[model samples]
Every structure is written in structure tokens, then in C-alpha cells.
Target chain A: LAKTTQPISMDSYEGQEVNITCSHNNIATNDYITWYQQFPSQGPRFIIQGYKTKVTNEVASLFIPADRKSSTLSLPRVSLSDTAVYYCLVGGSGNTPLVFGKGTRLSVIA
Target chain B: DAGVTQSPTHLIKTRGQHVTLRCSPISGHKSVSWYQQVLGQGPQFIFQYYEKEERGRGNFPDRFSARQFPNYSSELNVNALLLGDSALYLCASSLVGGDSNQPQHFGDGTRLSIL
Candidate 1:
């Protein structure tokens, strides 16, 4: 499994667009990048996923470069309800356990 | 659909005691994985079961055991629970296909408190 690095925390205001980046220096050829949003006292909710380039969904956008060593999760026009920890995971097939680093805590202020 | 469901939502057990936590996988999901999340930390893999067989396990001790039922639902059993086992036990289920990159869906975990 490839280890990941991300910011410990970030601050954003409501209606602002927030982008959090994650790095996996030893990314594998089959690894797919995924982002999950977690709120206090609840299980994580999937946001977006991508193999490379950009994939946009109703919830978020995942941007991956051709090298696939790093990816970014963009949350547009954030609301205070979006304040939560964001996890960036790199995995293949997606059944194996996802090892999480200290996730990036996004505090969306009103 | 119910998604993934676990119970009892909260539990308290004493050291030296045994406890069982149950999880119902999503309809048609064949793989169930368990994770332990300590306070202020990320989830740690404990075990994975697919098709009623043990497929993978993490670094936890033998005191931690799990089994998948015929129905594909599963249970995580901890014998002689230790204080270190006090944490949120999360159960995630995924379909058996390809590598594990399919983004496993999780259930609101069982919060186990060891006294």
C-alpha cells in the first residue's frame, strides 16, 4: 500500500471553493485515487474518484495528473455544513483496507 | 436499502471479558472488512472476509477473531478484551471484483468501550 501526505487542517469560508491536495510518492499503476468526507460521529461518505485527469460528480471533483502521483479534491461553493475531515486514499480494486493519514480537516466558516 | 448496518451501536465491556459485534453487509455484497479507529486517529484494518472465508488480517493479536456467516453478514469477536481495544469498530462491505480500489462503503461503527 502507498502512504499518503496531506495538510493537517485548512480554513475556508462559506461559498468559497476549497481545494485539498494529497501526495503518494510511490503510487502504483493500478491504484485509483478516491476522496471521502467524514463528519463527526458518522461514517465517511464517498465524494469522488478518478484514475487520471479530471472526473466531476454531483458532489465533488477529483483532479489527477497523468503521473498519478498526486490528486486534488475540489469542493465548490462550500457551506458551513461541509466542515469535516477529508481523506485521500489510493487503492486498487477497492476492497482492501484503506490506510488513512491524518486527514485534512476543512473548517468551513459561515 | 439499509446500506451497511452494525450493532449494538454502543457497547461496554470489561478487560478479560469477551464481546461480539455484528455487521450486516449491503444487499449482495460478498466482502466484509473490519477496522478499529482510536480516538483522534484513523481507522486500522483488523480483518477481511470474503465468501465466508478469511482473506486478510491486520497486526492485531489472536484475541481478535471474526467470521462471515453463510448469508455474507459477519461478526467480529474480541476475547479477553484489552483497554487498548477501546475504540470505534467500523464495518465496511464491498463486492468481490478487481483490486480493492472500488471505494468500500462503511457503516456507522460500533463504539466499544473497554473498562
Candidate 2:
């Protein structure tokens, strides 16, 4: 399993773009970066995932550099409902459960 | 389709007692994983089962045990519970192929309060 580092908290206004970066210097060859959004009292929801370069989905986008050591999750036009803790995970194997870090709490203020 | 479902949304127990947490995976999902989330912290993996076999285990002690049923439901059992054992128990389900890119679906979780 690869360890990940991320900001503890972030503040952003509505309609702004928020980017949260994660560092995984020891990322394995088979490791893939995944981001999840967790609201209060609910399970974390999958936002986006990427192996390298950029991958966009309906909810968010994930960008990974060639080194695979770091990645960022970009959320566009945020709203108050977007306030939640974001988790970055690095794992890829058969039935290997995801290991979560402290996660960055993003507060989308009005 | 319904997402992962956990039973007994909330439970209260005393120390030295045993507790059982149940999880029913989504339809067609063959893999189920368990996690423990303490307040103000991210969830920690406990176990993973696929095709009714144990596929992975976390660093938890032997007091934590889990098994998957034929229908892909899972149960997490903890014996001799301590005060520190109070937390939210989460269950996630995913489709397990040879690849590891499968996204997991999680449930609302079972909140266990130990006194």
C-alpha cells in the first residue's frame, strides 16, 4: 500500500474552481489514484480516478503527472452542497481494500 | 437498484460484550469490504471478501473477524469490545475482476456506541 499526503482543510467560495492535490511519492507501478467525497453521516462517494494524465467525469476531474507521484482533483463551479471531506487513495489489486488518509475537508462557503 | 445496505442503523453495547454487524451488498456485486471510521478520522480497512472467500485482511487484531455468505452478504464480528471500539462500521461492495479499477459502493454504515 502507498501512503498519501494532502491538505488538512481548504476554503473556497461558491462558483469557484477548487483543486486538491495529493502526494504519493512511493506510488507503486500498479497503483492508481482515486478521489472520494464524503458528506457528514454518509459513506464516501467516488468522484474521479486516474492512472496518468487527465480523466474527466460528470462530477469532477482527476489529473496525474507522468511521474505518478502526485495528482489533483478539480471541482468546477462549487456550491455549498459541495462541502465535505475529500479522500485520496492509492491502491490497485484484486480485492485490496482502500486505505484512506486524514483527507482534506473542503468548505464551500457562500 | 439499491446500494449497499447495513442492518441496525445504530447499536449500543457494553464493554466486554460481542457485537455483530451485517451488510448486504448491491445486486450483482460479488465483493464486500468492511471499514471502521472513528470520529474526525478517515475510515480504516478491516477485511475484504470476494466470491465467498477472504481476499484481504487489515492490521486489525484477531478480535475482528468477518465472513461472506453465498449471496455475497457479509458480517463483521468483534468480541470483547472495548471503549475504543465505538465507531461507525461501514460496508462497501464492488465488482471484482482481474483488474483493480473497480469503483466501490458504500452504505450509510452502522453506528456502534460502546459504554
TM-score for chain A, candidates 1 onward in order: 0.96, 0.97
Every model: Cα RMSD to truth: 1.2, 1.1
lDDT of 2 at B58: 89
Give the clashing pairs for model 2: none
lDDT of 2 by residue, A17-81 (tens): 99999999999998888898999889888888789999999999999999999999999999999
List, residue by residue over B1-115, the lDDT tens digit for candidate 1. Answer: 8889999999999999999999999998999999998887877889999899998899999999999999999999999989999999999898777554567888989999998
Best-fitting candidate, measured by DockQ? 2
Best-fitting candidate, scored by lDDT: 2
Report, for every candidate in turn, its global Cα lDDT versus the true structure: 0.88, 0.92
TM-score against truth, every candidate: 0.96, 0.97
Model 2 chain A TM-score equals 0.97
How accurately is candidate 2 docked according to DockQ?
0.67
In candidate 1 the C-alpha lDDT for residue B75 amounts to 98
lDDT (Cα, tens digit) per residue for candidate 1, span A1-110 = 89999999999999999999999989888888888888876777778888999999998988898899899999999999999999998882445777877799999988
Where is the poorest 10-residue window by lDDT in model 2 chain B?
B95-104
